[model samples]
Target: MIITLTLNPSVDISTTIDHLVPEQKLRCAAARYDPGGGGINVSRAIHRLGGKSRAVFPVGGATGSLLEQLVAEQQIDFQTVPMAGWTRQSFVVTETSTRQQFRFGLPGPAWSMDERELFLNTVLTFPKPIDYVVISGSFPPGLPADYCAVIARIVRQRGARLILDTSGEPLRMAVQEGAFLLKPNLGELASLVGVDKLELDEVEEAARSVIQRGWCEVVVLSLGPAGALLVAKTGHADQRIERFRVPAPTVKKQSTVGAGDSMVGGMIYALSQGKSYEEMLRFGVACGTAATMNPGTELFHKDDVERLLNWINQSGKKVFLPVADGIN
Candidate 1:
């Protein structure tokens, strides 16, 4: 089974405005609310694709109750650890004129030491072995920076694959534990490597270096419209690290919110089905493209994913870059 752990979850409210004028009171044309966080988004995307996965999260107060109801309405399996504080809410505003999105996220509720211990113990008591344990999103306040690293250790000790998709200090600590997969966008990767920014060549070197240092078995650096690069740690000269550049599809991009999370979901869904890395990346890219066709954090449906996959396969223009020997 696939399991996703979201340390900080929220009720995401998304609204659409014809144009975003900074100093004015603009009326929203449309709006929607959903349970959101990186890992929850992953679970929702997987469910949309007819995949089964459980979302494990911390909840508190009325907001948390609402989030639980929302998840249930979507038919997602969720397990929660109750907290003393109220859950947070986030706002995502999409400008229709330019297809630009702005997200305002709140600092989540603080967690007591006892609450943290309970969460860790609950995670340790999974009823069955999970195929993949996805640790994603920001850590709530009062949580340790090494929280993800500790979870990674637990997941590793249970012989399960760990996929981390996060940023900041938690990401820094988790990398030291060496997860099975680390999916960081270019900016996040740059932060992990302690650089202000990276040029294209620098990005490649940083990704490869992460793999070489044993911080992660595989490093996937997402390049937005340019697609993603996958670096494997096998170190075989003939084993070329694959780069899949998904040219942004020609569509009315209503929103880019949750596109990355959808991609991760698609990739994890494909991997859970025993698909090859190449196939997984292709499917993931398709899911991301399909997600852009909508207006919010809403993910791609199964039919949408299939349609996008068909378009990608028909295009037949994927580029493959061979890894030079002895580079590591």
Candidate 2:
């Protein structure tokens, strides 16, 4: 079984407006709400692709109930850890004319130490023989920065492969404990290595550096529109840094939100099915492109993902790679 943990889940409200006028009343052309947070998005994507996974998150207040209903509608298995405060909510405003989006996010509610303990205990009790565990998204207020690292350690100890996607200090700490995979965009990768930013030439070097430090066995650096780079662990003579560039497909612009999560979902789905790393990367790129073809925070549909996958297979480009120096 696959288990995904979202420490801070949210209710995503996306609205489309015709135009924006300073401090003036505006009418919305469309509005939609969805249960969100990185893990929830991953679970939804997996379900759409006909895979099974469970989503575990903390919930509270009216918003939490609404989120539960949304998940139930999708028929995805979910386990909610009750909290004393309301779950966070994010608002996405899109302009129809300009196709521009502005998002307002709220800091999630605080979690007491007891609540944190409960979360940890629940995770430890997950049925044994778990195949993979994904720890993604931000930490709620009052939750320690080491929260993700602790979860990753437990997951690893239980014999399940771990995939961690996050940013900043939590991500740094989690990587130190070592995970099976880490997916960070180019910018996030730069931050992880204490660099201000990285040019295209510097990406592979940075990715290889992370792997050498024992942070993860595989590091996938996502370069939006330019595709992604897969850095393999050192020492294996056959190991080499592979690069894939999925040219952004032409699409009516909407919102870029959730594209990264969709990519993670696609990659995990392929991995769970025992696909090769190259195939998984292609599927991930396809899923991300599909998500961008849609509006707002909505994820890619099964049919769209399939279409993109077919296109990717037909392209048949040899993803480039960088030469590896023995360092394992």
Candidate 3:
């Protein structure tokens, strides 16, 4: 079984306006609401791709109730931990004229120590043995940075792979303790290696450095439109690493919201299906590219993913990058 944890989930509301002038009364269209948060979006995307994952998150107040209703409406299996504070809401407004999107986010209500313990216990103590524990999104205010590291330790004890997709200090802490896989963008990957920024040619070395240090077994560096770079070990005791780069298939762009989560969701689904690392990257890029063809947080359709995957597989020869020497 696959389980996802979202520490700071939100109700994502998206709408459009004709224009944005000098802050005059801008009448917006009817709003569209979806369960917003890294793990929630990943679970929704997995469901859309004909896969299943149990989503675990906390809830509070009326907004939290609404979020539960939304998740239920999507037919996702979920378990919620109760909290005293209200959940946060995020807004995405698009200017119809220029097609520019503006996203406004709120820092979620601070979580108390007791509340944090309850939430963590709920996640780790699920009745079924979890095959993959995906802890995505950001930590709520007041949670310690070491929280992710603690989870990593416990997950290791249970012998389940943890696919961590997050950023900043919490992400760094998790890396120190190690995870099965990490999907960080170029910027986040640079931060992991203590760099301000990285050049395109420098991506492979930076990713390899993380693996060499025993932080993560696999690193999938997301490159936005250019596609993704994957680095992983061929065996446990082996110093050698395998690398692959899959280019994104061109598509008519609409909205970029949820594309990263869609990529993670697709990759996790592919992994659960016993696909090769190369096939996982290909299918994942297909899902992410397909997500760009929709507005708001609608994610991608299975048909679009299939068509794009076929196009990607037909060009598989270009996907494999030449193997490089082991960590020295």
Candidate 4:
């Protein structure tokens, strides 16, 4: 079974407006709400792809109450720990004229050490033997930077694969702790290696560096519209690393929200289905690209993923999976 952990969950609300003039009261269309958080979104995506994953997160306040209702509406299985602070809320306003979107996110309420312990115990005692443990999203205030790292260790002890899709110090710490897989954007990858910037051509080397250091066994460097680069640690330690780049299929664009999470969800679903790493990236990129065709935080549809994946497979480039010759 696949399990997802979302520490800082939220209720994402979005609406579109015609025009804005100096803070005037702007009339907008009806709003839409969805369960918002990295892991929650991933679970939702997984469900849409005809897969199953249990979403684990904290709950507090009336917002948390509503979040539960939304998750149930999506028919996702979930478990929650009581939190002291209210859950956060995110607002997105789209400018119909320019097609610009402004997202306002509130920092979630802080949690106490006892609360953290309870959540950790909950994970350690998951109902089933976990096949894959996905830890995504940000750590709420007061949670230690090593939050994901702790879960990484636990997942490893259980001999389950851990896929981390997060950023900043928490991501770095989890990498240090060693995860089975990672899905980091270009910017997040640069930060993991202590670089201020990276050229498109340098993405492969940077990703391999992470694998060689034992931080992760595989790295899926998401390049947004350019698609993703998959780096796997295979064969002898002295051999060159295996890598593949899948370009995203072109499509009508709507909102960019939830694309990355959708990709991670897709990849996870593919992995569970025993697909190759190359095909994993292809299907993942398809889901992410499909998500861009919808407004607000809506994820991709299975039909869209299938159509895009077919195009990507037919037009795949002659990219070789080179074995890693170690980090140096």
Candidate 5:
């Protein structure tokens, strides 16, 4: 089973105004509220893709209750750990005239030391075997970077693969502990490799470097509209890696809020179904691109994903794999 852990989940509120003029009481259309955060959104996207995943997060206060109700409405199974402070809320406003979007986020409440132990224990003691454990989103206040390393150890002990999507020191710690898969954008990739910048051609080598260091078995580099590149080990002692690239299909763009999470959902779901690496990347890109077709924190629809996946399969974009430059 797939289990997603969102350390700092939020209730997302989105609305659109005809014009976003400053110093004016501009009216907005009716607002839409949804459960938000990296892992939570991944669970939602997995559900939309006709898959199941259990979302695990801490909830507190009235806003937390609202978040639970919203997640329930999506028909996703979840488990929550109680927190002393309230869950955070995120706001998204779109200017209809200019097609511009503005997002506001609040920091999550701090977690006490006791609370941290309980949360870690809760994850470590899941009743059933977990096929994949996805730890996404930001670290809540007072949650140290090493907590990610602790999580990595838990996944290892449980014999489950870990899929990580985060930034900064937490990301570094988690990578140091090793993971099955990592979804990092270009900027995050550059950071992981200790570089200031990375050109398009430099991406493959940078990703493979992470694999060579035994940090992760697979690195899916998210390149936004340019699509994604996958660098993974072939599982032989030779330390050879295979690479594949897929371009994002053009669509009427909306909001890019949950596209990365959607991509994670799609890829993990495909992996659970025993799909090939190329198929997984295609589905992931399709789900991510399809998510851009909707506004606000919404994920992709099943129909849209299927259509986009078919398009990707027929687009004739070649999957590039060079001769094995065996890891030293």
Candidate 6:
């Protein structure tokens, strides 16, 4: 089973206003509420693509209760660890005239040391044999800097592959622990490799460095509209490392929210299906680009992903070795 962890979940409130004039008592359309968090959204997208994943996160207070209700409405299976603080909410306001979107996020409640232990224990004690464990989103306050590393060890002990999608120090620490794969954008990748920034020509070399160091088995570099680059060591000892670039499909733009998480979800779903790495990356780019065609935090539609995947395959994208038809 695929399991996702969102350390800090949220109740996302999005609305649109005709205009924004300073302190003018601006009015907005009726607010729309959706569950918001990296891994949570990944689970949501996976479900959208006809897959099942259990979402595990900490919840507290009335807002937490509402968050659970919202997720339940989406029919995603979940387990919540009790917490001492209320779950936070985020605001997304769009200016209809200019199509400008503004997002405001609130810090989550700090967890005490004891509370943090319980949280980790909850994940460690997951009953089933987890095939994939996805840990994404920001580290909640009061959590240790190496929290992802701790989680990496737990999942490793269970013999489950880990998919890490996080940023900053936690990401750097987690990479050292190693994982099945990582999806880091340009900026996050630069930081992990100790660079101020990376030029276009430096991406492949930088990504190759990460894999060469054995930090992770797979590194998927997300290049936004340009596409993604996949670099990895060969499974056979004598075989060489390989790289593939899946170009992004051009589409009308909307809100970019949830696109990255959707991309991660798509790749994970493809992996679960025993598809090739090229297929996984192709489907991932398809999902991400599709997500950008819609407004708000809404993810991609399955139909859109299917069409884009067809386009990618038709455009002669690079291929990777296929997985066994029956690996179960």
Model 2 Cα lDDT, one tens digit per residue, 184-213:
987789999999999989987888788878
- Give lDDT tens digits, candidate 4, residues 77-124: 999999878999999888999999898999999988899899999988
lDDT of 3 by residue, 1-328 (tens): 8888899999999999989788598899999999989999999989998899999999999999999999999999999999999999999998989999888999888988899889778756876677898989988898899898888887877888999999999999988888999999988999999999999999999999999899998999999999999998867465678889998998888899899999999999999999988888898999999998988877889999999999998888776564756766
RMSD list, candidates in order: 2.3, 2.0, 1.3, 1.8, 1.3, 3.8
For residues 1-328, could you state the per-residue lDDT of candidate 6 as single tens digits?
9999999999988889988899688878988899999999999989999999999999999999999999999999999999989999989888899999999999988998888899889987997788999998987886888988999989988999999999999999988888989999999999989999999899978887887777888889999999888887657655467778888988888888889999999999999999978788988999999998877777788999899888888885343323221101
Off by over 4 Å in 4: 235-240, 318-328
Candidate 1 local Cα displacement, residue 214, angstroms: 0.8
Candidate 3: list runs displaced more than 4 Å.
Answer: 319-324
List residue ranges in candidate 2 displaced over 4 A. Answer: 234-248, 318-328
Worst 10 residues of 5 by lDDT: 316-325
State every prediction's TM-score relative to the real structure.
0.92, 0.94, 0.97, 0.95, 0.97, 0.95
Name the TM-score of candidate 6.
0.95
Which clashing pairs does model 2 show? Answer: none
The local lDDT score (0 to 100) that residue 317 gets in candidate 6 is 31
Worst 10 residues of 4 by lDDT: 318-327
lDDT of 3 at 42: 93
Per-residue lDDT of model 5, residues 12-122, tens digit only: 999999888889988999999999999999999899878899999999999999999999999999999999999999999998999999999999999999889999999
lDDT of 3 at 251: 89
Candidate 2 clash figure, as a count:
0
Which candidate model has the greater lDDT, 3 or 4?
A: 3
**Residue 15 CA error for candidate 1 (Å)?**
2.0
Worst 10 residues of 3 by lDDT: 319-328
